[model samples]
Target chain A: MSPPAALRAAGLVKSYRRGRAVDGVDLTVALGERVALLGPNGAGKTTTLLMCLGAVTPDAGTVEILGHRLPRERSHALARVGFTAGYLPLPERMRVVEYLRLYARLAGLRRPDVAARAALDRFGVSHLARAMGTELSSGQKTLVGIAKAVLHRPALLVLDEPTASLDPDVALRVRTGLREISAELGTALLVTSHNMVEVERLCERVVFLSAGQVVANGTPAQIIDRYGHDDLEGVFLHLS
Target chain B: MPTIEVYHGAAASFWRVMAIARRHAYVLQRSPHRLFDIIVWPVVDVILFGTIGVFAAGRLGGAGQVALYLLVGVVLWHVVYQAQISLATGFLEETWSRTVLSLLVTPMREWEYVAGVALFGLVKLLGGVGAVALIAWAAYAFKITTLGWGLIPVAALLLAVGWAIALFVIGLVLRFGSGAEALAWGILFVVMPLSGTFYPVSALPAVLRPIGTLLPTTHAFAAGRAFAQGAATPWHELGLAAAGTAVMLALGFGYVVWMLRVFRARGFVTRYS
Candidate 1:
């Protein structure tokens, strides 16, 4: 029998009082495969991510992370999963090393400090180790956050708009680090971003959502070709 | 790297809990305001209130009895308040830093987080409560240790009451978000007056007596007060408070867990955006 996918979220549904936010969304990310979920505002992207992370219970459907089901086996699933997002910033009072070390321990690493240092080195941000969260610039914070997330080297790493706020140069650094993580660690990447250029550069495939449902799912080049657009952004503009 | 080796069971839970406490400790070590909170204001409270208790002795015609009554109440009040504030604010710290969702995604369970914050609170209030106790002794000739071995149960019941109240407030915050955040401090306004922390339950009016009696802290205070007035061990009252405290913990912990589920179901936790 084949190994289960790194992540399989099937037939997911969610609703708020206003209306259904996510409707019958199915998403899967294979081991070491890089995929992005792209959508505009109110497209239910965050809701879907939260459900898959087991932070929000689904109205209907099942989500499995590395073959461990969510909302039921949430603890076991979370133990092997690492997540980072721009919205969830690092703790302002904690130094970068302190934050990473704590998460490493939380992930049950035997040598959290060593693992944290290796993660910092992997992201090429070892100089920011002693800086407090309040001291780091936005780009630096994102790097530290990624290091913290990957410290335990989980099978899957979920990132939300990981480079959304950075300057082009810093964004390049982030993209390079993420690509290395995907290639060297074989960490399955499930990303959400509006940066179509970065999506094309970093992710092998794209899943586009509009009004709470998947409207397009293919390789960036294929999606662009299918829509007769010059690039992924043009395709996005076409969909929007 | 597929190097994920997730820790499991009780031992892992211990380290996870300590990780949370250590995170707070780092904040505590660096933030001046946090240090002020642990030391300055609580010490000021002891001096300010202990003076009142001493003045009330003259006004109430009991020499030192009224002093002990109010002073003992104030000291224990700090004990309970410290437990509640420490836990509530520790949890609040996560929200302010926007790390609550991050912590949730980790292998750490909800109970472990709660216990960790409560554990930190326990470590913290010891210094705060001890400082207050020392001042109460030096300034007002009121040594809490005079309660002797009885001090254990008195402080235990009071701490239980504090934790119960804080847990419920946390549940409110989880379900309602910051709309209920004020209760983290404001609820104490109602709790302090209703629990009769400053006076004897018998001193309260008939309409309010039953309400005061219902609080485990009230029963615990009654024992402390009886001892101050030269009665030996007030086991009957202590016994009652202990039983009441057990009920309170069950209700408080259960309420928080249910609210957490509701937070998940209603997807309020997605507000991290």
Candidate 2:
């Protein structure tokens, strides 16, 4: 039998008085598959991602993560799903290890401290485990945030602009680390980013969202060909 | 997302609750200033209030009567005030750190978060109450424990009021964001004057009398004062306080749960995240 989909969102819709933020969107990621969600500002990419994570309730539609339905069974779904966003901040007063341990425990790890230690090691951040969250640079925080998300070895991992603020060197390192980690764990990855280079490097398939609708979905090369462009960035600009 | 079977069983759920409490405790540990503030504030309040209580008691009644009265009022009021602030601040802390999104993504339920924060507040309540009780006995010869075993019910009722106020504050913070943070500290004071903490409910203006009578604090302090004076524990006032607590709990819990659902539906989860 085919593996269950990592994420499945159907006819999702969300609206504000100003306008619809996400409108009748459907998306899916298969088990162990890596996918990228691409869109311009106001294209509702983030809103869709939020719905998949069950953080935002859809106005209309269904989302199933790892087979559990959204909003209703979010708690069950979230147990094996992890999320990280570059913009989400960690507690300033907590040490890195302390923060990670808290999340590990919340994720229901049997030995949270051990899992936290291993995550820190996997991310090569064990050296900074004692540092306070506020003391870390944006790049370091991103690394720690990613480490926290993966501590429980979640089956489905969602990342929003994971390396948005990192320098080229750090971003490259993050990309390499994520690739290695995902491969080792066989975790399905759903990522949203404007960095076409990062998307091209990490995601085999891309879903282009425009005005809260999926305008394009295919391999990077296929999208490039469809847009009559030489690269993924050209296709992104064309669709967005 | 693939429906992965990764259930954190009932046993683990309990641990998750403790983990939330542990998270707050670690934050407190890292910030000695926060711990110091919680400990020092109540002690200072006792010293300041106790001195005034001494002078005020000379005018109203015997020293012993005044000390017990003042001590009970001060201690119980802190219990209510600190409990509300502690719970409200727990929510605010998550907002300030932009960690609410991180928290919501886990298997942790809203009730788990509430219970954990409430537990943390209970710890603070103990610290504040302990320090005040010690000072009351050491300095004023007034034993707070002497309010009889009935003090347990009184304290529980007062804490219920605190939890209600805390839930209201949580609703405000969730709805209005950090801008309404001042309500955490300001809310208790708004009701304090009408609460009949230092005076009888009848002393208030006629229009304010009904409002005072409705507040659980007013009834709590009345019963506490009566107990201090070696009078019959005011069972009627205690009953009124319990009824009032029920109302506040309903309103507070109802408002918070409703606002949270609206917030989640509106995708406000990422507002701070």
Candidate 3:
């Protein structure tokens, strides 16, 4: 028998009166696999991620994360899943350490401070622990956000444009640190990014989404080869 | 249909609720304005009305009882008003901070989260009411405790009414987004005039009297006035108020649950955009 996949989503459909956000989508990420989700704006990347995390209930679909069904067994499923997004900011009134500790506790860590500190140290943001969340620069906020996301060492870590708005140098550092952490912890990573460079650098496999559907799925090299393109960015343009 | 597997039993659920309460306490401890709103505003309202009652006693008939009457009404009304405000704003705060998505992605269930907010709001309400009662006694020589052990049940029923209103506001905000946040502070005041806080329910116009009787605060204040006049216990009024509160609570919880389902289905539960 095979080991259970970290994430399994099938026939996922979500629609607002505005229009269909996600339509008949199926996705899976193997344990310890790092996959990039690429799509243009309004392509349902955020909607799909929310459904997989059990943050949003799909109108018609099924999702299981770490072997637990969504919405029904969401509590169990959420315990092993971590998520970070540039769009979802932390509370400004809370200090960095306080914010991280809250999430650690919510994730059910026994000693939230210890887990929080480890995440801070790992992300090289330990010195900023006492600073208010509002005081941080854009890059600093992303670093703190990622540290909070990984504090409990979730089995599946999801990121939506994690490096969006950072300076190039800081973005590179975060990309490198996240890649190293995922490899060290053997955590399955599902990342969505518009930056093809980050995708090519961090992901082993790539899934391109367009118009609420998965348009292409393969390794970066395979995608570039299949699409007759020189790089991942060229492939994204061709597909999206 | 898939069945939900609850991770925590009763005990663990309590701890999760406490964690949320603790988070609010941390915020209150840090922000003076939040603390002031919870503690100072009610006391000021009591003093303001209490002073008016004192002055009116010298000038008009039946005015001597005004001080105690208004004091009791303001103090008790805070129990419900503050509770509703605190809990509704507690939920709204998450949306403003854009942290609702992060919270929903956790292992905590919806009921646990709501319970936590309500508990914290209750605690804040207790402190505010206690402060007002203390000040009323120390400064004016009026004793709210004179209402005796019956005050406990009265306060509980009022808090339940507050919880119901807060839940209803939360449901509205969840359905309509933060654009409806004004409902948190505004809804309570809409009911205040009809609640007969300063006047007896009989003083309301005949047409308004029927609507007034349906309000939990109406029965609470009536019982409070009877207690002030030395009624041993206003079981009749308390019983009716309790029944009214139960209905409001059921409606509030139903609205909250239904709105939450709408939020989830409409993809409003975790959108940061």
lDDT of 3 at A171: 91
The C-alpha stretches of model 2 lying farther than 4 A from their native spots are: A1-3, B1-7, B60-67
Error of 2 at A157 (Å): 0.3
Off by over 4 Å in 1: B1-6
Candidate 3's DockQ: 0.43
lDDT of all the models against the reference?
A: 0.86, 0.86, 0.85
Q: Give lDDT for model 2.
A: 0.86
lDDT of 1 by residue, B100-189 (tens): 789888888888898888899998899888888888888878888766777788888899888999999999988888788889888877
The positional error of residue B136 in candidate 3, measured at the CA in angstroms, is 1.7
| TM-score attained by chain A of model 2 | 0.97
Candidate 2 CAPRI assessment class: medium
For each of the candidates, what fraction of the native contacts does it recover? 0.79, 0.77, 0.56
Tens digits of lDDT, candidate 1, A41-101 = 8898888999999988989999999898887788888877889997677888989989998
TM-score of each prediction: 0.96, 0.95, 0.95
What's model 2's lDDT at A158? 94
Could you say which candidate leads in TM-score?
1
